[model samples]
Target: MRQPRPRPRLLPLTPRRLPLTAALAALGGLAGCISGDGGTPPDTAPPAVHLQQPAEGQELAQPALQVVGFIRDDRGVQRAEYSLNGGPPQPVALTPNPDGSRSFGFQAALAEGANRLRVVAYDAAGNAGAAERRVTYRPPPPLPAAVEIDPSAFAGGWWDRYGPTYDSNPALADHGVSHTHLYGNDAGYVEYAFTLDRPPGTALATLRARLSSNFPGWSGPADGESDVTVYLNGKEQGTRRVMADNGSGGEYRFALAPADFVAGRNVLRLEVKSGSAKKNGLAIYYRALLPGFVDTPISIAFSAQPLPSFTLEPLYAPGAAAFAIAQGADALYYFKINRQNGFDVPAQNFESTGFTGSILGTDLNRVKVTFRKDLSSGDRLAVVVQAGPQAPLGEHAFWAEGRGGGVGSSPAAVNLRVVACSSGCR
Candidate 1:
């Protein structure tokens, strides 16, 4: 049989503070109260105290609380002190009141939940009086818009899907005339709303909106694009002076922090503020506010083989140098891999899947790679990259990781670089 454990000894607890009324009541015998008919002897009664602000059991939205009131005695009030929720007492300044008595006032920062305020007043003879009040401080909740708009409301000839079709088609223009959706002098407005998530974590991984405009052959005005204002739940977020990437159509994007966004429903409004006749038309394409899958990454790699260590170079298309990696520019990186081991390659669904990698702290601009196995040196899956839709024009670096081969074979990761589209590109 197991031996019984001895009972744990309990420590003595500290004394709890008495309420102001109770504490002053216990001091009642030492000091006499004011006479019922105001006939008390001058030296017999103690000072009197009263609370003037924040009446008992009041609720407040602001944490900064003001305590004000009057203190009086026949021989004159000496000093006043106060405390909140049993904390240390702080001295309150006394000012002369118009009624021949003295008044006291001070401010205090209140903590959340119920707060107990205690005030003390004393006369020159050392007699004391006490009073108390209760208050509560709480902030209101954030408000989210309970509205939404259909995604199809943005479809038209001037606008297109976000994919390859979004690219500008000069052939669509008539006799070298620029094809653009016009908005000038008067504002063109559109509204949409969406419901995010609550509970504080990552509800939506990525929120994106892509758009662009068309510029006619004319030199137009100095500040090319029109003012595009974005509003979130009736408040201004930012304003973009949007124009095409040169005279041609170039995609422009705006992004928001996932964590800072409110939980639940939210509203988004876009307005094209008044513009001039010479420069107000835009070829609007691929505009959407979309939520994306962030953590849903499928295992991808070069091959399922006992990979031999080797180096690789940046693979790009012929027009890449002139155009760079542009917004909505789809790129395929060709890689020659030797999969001498087993099969670790997943089947490709090019149109449905997207691939991505990170360099330093920035996410690499890459879409999907639809390649398969060939057991030759650097001969299989090609790493596809897309230029940063929001990244600046410069040389960018990243790594491409391949499938991890089982049975004593390790996975492979290759370093790569892609030059972003330059601002000078049309």
Candidate 2:
């Protein structure tokens, strides 16, 4: 049998309550730990900020730059302000975000040089959060002055599909003669060579010239219209079909690219293309305005390949017994002639004549004779004959003396019959 357990004394239950003043003090203390605004928890964490524009340490051109960024705090942001260069803080409006955050924008009045910008945000609990950035301000430098290249500094000559036929040095001059076409079946071009010290970089260069399309027609699309293909350094730059009103010439301009130029040798080619075989002309006095460039002295003389010297002979028989001319007539005549009577070899000879119009009271004593050699087209000898207003009207025979190539003038003498003009002398 188990021994009976002794009965324990049961103590009476006591219910204790705090004094009213003490309970009130405890509640007040708890309330003081929390936020006073709408029973929210106390906010001890400072606000965090992120810059959205005008990145930190960035250089700005304008002084009045707007700084954009977002500010966040555990408690709602009450107000925000920004201080530039330690100046007085200017209040900025805070925009509420969806994620319990706010954004603020302010235009900072930055001084020249480095500026220290400080943005501060405050919460309802007076907790301050700050974001700082260092920025720089600078004014842009002045632009470089434009340098104009002289027209006479260029070199090269007129070219054709066959080859270069005429050499024009210091390549800027007025040409009022018949030039072959550079486009269509009859193709030709005028090329110029020059050099530049430096490139124009990003700046555009201006090229102005006076030219003629040689298109004789009414003042419409085809009138004064010429197709020009511009090339730089053997690379095609651009093409333009321009029209000119005046017969003397038309003013045309082209904008050259800075990359088209080099420090050393550079070639500028103007190719003229036309459906008709009419002559086109290019005048002098063009301007090449290049920015940040210095002219480089260069020279391009004669053709690429000069033929060896040979003899001179008539290419065809004289068709007429005597050629007729009017008084005071200035004309240039071509004789189909060559050396060795074929296009096998290139040749040249000096020609002289004795015909003085001293008794006729006129200066028709000297005559100029030149040779034009084109391998593709036949060769010829050009003679310039000038007759004064009071020239003698009669048949005159003249003999030509030839030197070099061990050859003499053929056919003995050329017959010339002077006649009076029916209207006016040309």
Candidate 3:
């Protein structure tokens, strides 16, 4: 190591020494400021706040309350507080949601009446902002009674109108009677006619009729087809086709104008045609515009035995059973069997039973049964196998009668059937 010329004696400046130099420079600046050499003061901005949900004077029906807002500046939000109806403030988390909106929700039991909600937001910089809204809270409304009817009372020429009975049977007793008759010849062609007692101020909207089975007893090879034409006040309204072989029996559902119904009476006429034997009957049901129109028919469903080919006897065991009287349309009949004779079934008077039923007028083929009570065991029921129409020129009287007694349930028994009349048989 040859002795290099003595390097100029130099001292290293340590990190501590550098800081000291900076401190001296700061002091010099202060001295200069005292000499009036300082720059202008810095500019400061305040944080901002806004509210999103529950506009002013809004109504809130739900339980959970969500308070949302936004704040400007990176001075991250610190805490959020909310109050309902001037109550004590509740602290809420300042968590940012994935939707870029900050929200705070609390399980608050607000006062019953009018309520005022206030939300206050604070940031890390101690900047605070607030918003408020007025809201009303109310309870829900009560429920309404359900729409219903009875099918058993639908039998006979007319259904007796009664009051709303909370009893298992909701239908009122026969207030008026609806007359329906089927008259046909061996040719399988039938005609049906009926008269309805239209109550004062009542508006009839729909007329419905259901058949127990398709046209029967016809020998023609062509599938029997039934035609239904509706006449309002003897004026033609509309007509529809009913097919029996396709499994669609007969149903005629048509809309009636208010003028079509008179304050005292309204008449309806139906015509039927079959390819073979005249084997079918109809059960009619009507609907009015007014609620609780006691005299109007609500539902009319019917049952029939296997006919034409299958001589299967009508199942009459007292119980709930479904029967397909027409294609795509089936009727339910509830039978109650008993040892005593409490039920009186005469040649007429089928409306006393408590069965809720319905009939569609489109083809008069389908019947629907809704029972309030079940039927007793071993009950015998007479169901119509087939029926058809006849000429209006004859004087025919058709009726049904029966008698029975037993330990009957609330609804008793419900049965549907088709009535047929040959020459001079109506």
**Which candidate has the top score in lDDT?**
2
- Candidate that would win on TM-score: 2
lDDT for each residue of candidate 3 in 84-137, tens digit (9 for 90 to 100): 887888886654532233544344555656888887777666667777877776
Question: What is the alpha-carbon lDDT of model 1 when measured against the actual structure?
Answer: 0.49
Candidate 2's displacement at residue 74, Å, is: 4.5
Q: Total clashing residue pairs per candidate?
A: 10, 4, 72
Judged by lDDT relative to the true structure, which candidate is superior, 1 or 2? 2
Each model's C-alpha lDDT? 0.49, 0.51, 0.38
Using TM-score as the measure, name the better of candidate 1 and candidate 2.
2
For candidate 1, list the clashing residue pairs, or say none. 214-283, 301-402, 301-403, 305-341, 306-341, 336-378, 336-379, 337-378, 337-379, 355-367
**lDDT of model 2 at position 269:** 76
lDDT of 1 at 158: 26
lDDT of 3 at 178: 22
lDDT by residue for model 1 over 1-426, one digit each (tens)?
A: 999999998544434344655666656634554434434555757878866665799776558776756777778888889999999989988866434456665789999889999999888778888889999987433322222233234322221212112223444344332322222222454555565555223222222333344333424443455566665556665666666543224434443333345666556655564553323433333322123311111111111112323344444443556334455666555644444444333333222235455432235565455555423444445555666443333333343334322212122334444443333221
Residue 125, candidate 3: Cα error in Å is: 4.3
Task: Give the total clashing residue pairs for model 3.
Answer: 72
Summarize candidate 2's per-residue lDDT along 1-426 as a digit string, tens digits: 999999998544433244665676777777776646336565788878665545589776557666766777776788888888999989988766445667555576779999998889888888998888999987433323444434444455553323333223222223322221112112356666665655544344566555555422223334434567778788777776655433234456676665567766678876665453442433332332233322221122211111223332322223333334457667444444333433243345343333232212223544566554532234555556676343343433333323333222222223334443221221
Q: Which ranges of candidate 1 are over 4 A from the true structure?
A: 1-42, 97-99, 140-194, 198-267, 273-279, 282-426
